[model samples]
Target: MLHDIGGQAPNPRQTKIAVVGGGSTYTPELIDGFARLRDTLPIGELVLVDPAAERLELVGGLARRIFAKQGHPATVTTTSDLDAGVAGADAVLLQLRVGGQAARQQDETWPLECGCIGQETTGAGGLAKALRTVPVVLDIAERVRRASPDAWIIDFTNPVGIVTRALLQAGHRAIGLCNVAIGFQRKFAALLGVAPGDVHLDHVGLNHLTWERGVRLGGPEGENVLPKLLAEHGDTIAGDLHLPRPLLDRLGTVPSYYLRYFYAHDAVVEEMWTKPSRAAEVAAMEKQLLEMYGDPALDEKPALLAKRGGAFYSEAAVDLAAALLGSGGSPYQVVNTYNNGTLPFLADDAVIEVQAAIGARGATPLPVPQLDPLCAGLVANVTAYEQLALEAALHGGRDRVFKALLAHPLIGQYAYAESLTDQLIAHNQEHLAWA
Candidate 1:
């Protein structure tokens, strides 16, 4: 059993929260998350921040409706001012992605020309995004430090593991959250025709780049069913899904992310084309959804979530947050927290995801005893490059940035490392403002 730090649920009371980037499509889910916990974590006030007034109002309005409908008396405020949003809050959530989806697509695609996978969440794409995001995220961290000195930051940004590592190294209290692993686990269980709870998993490593070491179904009684289920039921579930699972099934190990690169290894370009075509597929799916229906924007309105009246926050997002706040109950989650040697397979200082127990003391990442060699090597390599990039971001220099780019396994030891480095830098030079 996992430990629960929150001794008991706090009584209903006002709690101030600052949600940065309120205009994001994710705001409604966040607001709903708070509503579900209102009985224990009463909302005193909510501060919403965004640049566009109209977008801010839309999300802010939705937040209000959720709160009112839940019978919570929390006051909601919208602002374009950054400092005002950070002031007097118990917690702050950072959810901004600098260049949006189009920019991300470019970041991933350009790296494909070189025969490497171009995903902004990991590898060289992760480094490039870190260069662009560290400054912005840190700026928000600074505001939280000054305005709400004791507040804990919940980061929902991409490259979450790397970003969370940077913040903690800089002496800020923060936790980065992602649900990719959980999403995949559920998909796998459904493929095997088992209840999600009936499936047990061992997950480790960074966001968008972890591996499931073991899987068991049916608990002690169901232990005998796993092999047969793997042999027969696997096809049904694998066939229904349109993701990396099929590859994972063939390898006899769950595929967390490496599968994307497996199928499109030769399409990698330079830095600008780093995102894999798999992302393009997801975009294409979204576009097809829009076209299939009469609407052009499928996600413009609310989405049909997994649970009803569960929370506004994404199911994965809420699971992490509520676990930290002591209101959630999930078997396990691999979240980004300060690496205090949780994953022995990697460096102690390398931030990673292992099992975690969230309660009164906040998220407590558990230790991982062992890991698959492939996953360990990949995470270590990525973390090495990522740490160098963080250093470059902190102390602006071409040398540090180049060193980081060259250190990457995909880009390292290649004759074109210098030229590729130069071209990549030139393409994403806007990121140089920070480095």
Candidate 2:
């Protein structure tokens, strides 16, 4: 946390933000947010940094055009150098994919061979991603820290908990970012017929493993409308969660979509085998998105970008950055920061995603209700797995990977961990340096 020389008032100074994975198809969405949110986070410059030269050119050019069309005054630049791109920037946003869609394809496939749920950021697959991603992210973070020591590192990477913990352990000023909580905020707001700003959610637990127990109106002290939401929208919400309405009604809480992988492990594994990997789908969409960006007249975010996923991501990033940089807006936003006793059961250093008051000093987790035994137990289980996953990610080995997988509730069986560990290393040999 940096010292606040000025009071809690919003800082009007212009800022420089560098997007580490600027070549991603998602960059335009972020650029669109910056254009619309100029009043919130005034940008002096926005740099796009990526190793892929071709994609960087397309994404950066379209980014400049989008800003120009929106009458935004910020400068947009493209670069392959992480150090130069981050040098003197106020903040850096990380949205990197190490093996591109190919690695993600492997991550989503191999675990299924051993009868485990195959997903990018959980189970055996997420472990593989953590192995491939953590070192790369750490290397890049070192450059960011050197280039701009005071810059805030906002990570939007997959397997966010493991990657973020790695960053924080290394003593970087980092806070993980995800769009899941914001998705719920937007949904509840739309249902309540109130502006999203008026809604505050009790988003507890870790990334991907979270629950919305209470949805309050106005501020944190406002009336909790969670019961009304469940009673009136149970069926719709159940459909979204893929859980039986009885289960949601029984627990009196709405779990995140990723919970489906756990709550219905065998069912999801059987279904995942038949469907193409999400990476394959996103790759196809990225092709079309790049084509659309090449259009000289195209400036606004294309409809196909929605198909690429990450709906309302730019808005969340804008709000979070504005809050973190002390630009303005409400005092609280849901973010991935250290627990610091937010969950009494979890370690103080454990990273949890919950409502946090953001400012120049950093985020402090807001007060949350006592966790139900069910949610607390699951949260504790996953947090242990994440810690082991980070260990395996940092110091690579087949045994370490196996231990991490065994720690996961979904792959607790010794047989599954052994076979999945072998398959993970085999599938991701290129991405895993030790392999």
Candidate 3:
């Protein structure tokens, strides 16, 4: 790793940003994104917090190099101590997990064997992960209050909505981050062969669990783009591409995985054991890409001012950051924010993802017009699950956990729900000792 001592003096009023999981494979891109903002904004210091010393050092070294190369050297510190890392920070970014990816794969596949949707994003997988995470996340939040009392938490963890809601319920300043909130519409625009700028969409519900109620072209035919997209690219968009395509096509519109559970229905799988073939195909493609690229960590270290390829580095994420920073004074698109009774279908205090006007203060959730029956039911189930999980966390009662599992759509029967709940709790013996 290299370091560059920049030629510029530090701005006294700059904000300090702390990325909690700096060792994560995804941090390079995010760090690169923040580095590019140096020219337009005054960021005083950058902190990378991770428990692994080697990984922590690598990221800190990268940040120093990036800053020096840009001729704007900001103080860079790496630490295993989260308290020291978050001290004086303006934002705490989280992307940690109790169980790694392999464990997550087990969480998904095992539930699949039980005839349930196997995804960390929603359903049983989400509920299980949420149960394990609530305590840890709350601990982190309490520290944030003590260290940086006014700091905002930018959560990038799985069970995004659930975890975000838990922190908010505890009265912390936090907002969950989900690419699905905006990535789905971008996918829709690509299928229609139009610039994403030319697409207009309305989305609502929870993270990885939402429905796109409207779609339109910004051009002459501003009518709903759903019927056309469904008629033209329906099969290829939903079928050939593995993702929300099938779910969206079934609803005759797009399904935002922002709240995926809402879109789970009888047609999502064949007899509930198999997902559409597109998911399999996409998985294969992703596997091939990983095999070709291997772990990004193995390559020669990224340059101090290096830029990664693809839209993630170049377009979408950059656009979102710029919009939030008020770069062009362009209106920020709506996104998931705390509902202040704006959405009638969900509880007033529920942290729901909706279209919002973003600014320096961050996202402001907008009111949704209405929710279809399926979407409404999904919001209800997931919201109820979160509430029950909170109750379980507060009281340390496994009964609350059992009730959450019982309320799941696929396991709503009293006997089946209780049996599955007992089995899961039994299996998670080590983690559930407190409850």
Candidate 4:
């Protein structure tokens, strides 16, 4: 990848931002961020777009209350009309779920029946989500493009790499955002007795398939702290990764939690069969969260949002939006952008999540140190599979789905691929128009 080093001052101006999936239980978390970071982002208007009227009412009301409670000046609005919602927006955030938790339940369950990881952003299940989500998201992106040509799309949707790639492929001004990298930076910063701002990670690889090969303190070259973190907090770290400390010590790099679906695939699959799917758990949490949101007195985000996952999501989203919209902050942040020869192995067109300096022109991948063979091998394999998965998601067929499953590292067996293809299609028939 090519690297350009520089800094630019942010032009202070009021912004009108739209949250495409505003009814999501996660919206409050984002609203809370906006309220706290108001001095930085300075929102003029905030719109929540969703087809669910009741959810929009509950979420929009609570969002307004949160801003009011924080004494924020932004006005919050709710709407089902995409064109109206995105009209004149400076930036649009996408976080939609195609079939809700019921569909997610199917994605998480059927994959385990074929002995594959059931997570929503990594393997077969993630592919199912991509297939159902891509078309809807593209349509939304098109509306944003039409309504406001200069609008920047910040995607927080699942299967982020695929969705971001689809948006970019359609010539939309977009960038992908994920919490995994920031979550690690915050954790490492806490352990090192420093502010999260002091830590910068060599977070590399495709979405959900990345690793922190190096952790630099103060600046990109300040000091390497990955060894120190692994040495002192190895057990706690290992528990979070669900991998052995010895493996981390051996590799001398910390992998993202999603890597567990790869390093310990069979174990995860076996263990998953014994528990309720994450979708079921999140669905129940949303039920309680919506109830809490309906309370007029509850102005702050519920504590239960932490259990809803996406920790530090609002901060990352705000940071990215500010940088993308020219409220310049840090010089670098982990983002999903075009590879542009960053890996030297993957196609330039392949979207890889890496550190990049954000500007109004969008992200340019930072120069990366040579990757170890082990990491490169897994990244290359998964990137190829992601290519096929995106193709299948865009143009569906039983054979294409089978092809995607067969290419997955966690489901390489022909028998497993065939069975998963049949079961996945059957389970997702409602969402899969092609099926």
> How many clashes in each structure?
30, 0, 15, 1
lDDT of each: 0.64, 0.88, 0.63, 0.88
Lowest-sum lDDT 10-residue window in model 2: 1-10
lDDT of 4 by residue, 28-96 (tens): 999999999976677888889888878888998888888878888766778888899898899999999
**RMSD to the hidden true structure, all candidates:** 7.1, 4.8, 5.5, 5.8
Scored by Cα lDDT, where does model 3 land? 0.63
Candidate 1 worst ten-residue window by lDDT: 1-10
RMSD in angstroms between candidate 4 and the native structure over all alpha carbons? 5.8
lDDT of 4 at 213: 89
| Residue-wise C-alpha lDDT for candidate 2, range 1-435, written one tens digit per residue | 111111223232579898999999999999999999999989887888988888888887788788888888776777887888888888899999999998888888888888888888999889989999999999999999889999999999988888999999999999899999889999999988999999999889999999998999998899999999999989998998789999999889899999999899999999888888898998888999989888878878998898787888899998888888888756888889899998888899999999999998888999878998999999999999999999988989989999999999999999999899889888888887888
Q: Tell me how far the alpha carbon of residue 156 in candidate 2 is from the true structure, in angstroms, after superposition.
A: 0.4
Best by lDDT: 2
Residue 226's C-alpha lDDT in candidate 3? 77
Per-residue lDDT tens digits of candidate 1, residues 401-434?
7788787776775554555556557667776774
* Tens digits of lDDT, candidate 3, 358-397: 6667777655676778668767777777777667655566
Q: What is the lDDT of residue 418 in candidate 1?
A: 59
Lowest lDDT block of 10, candidate 4: 1-10
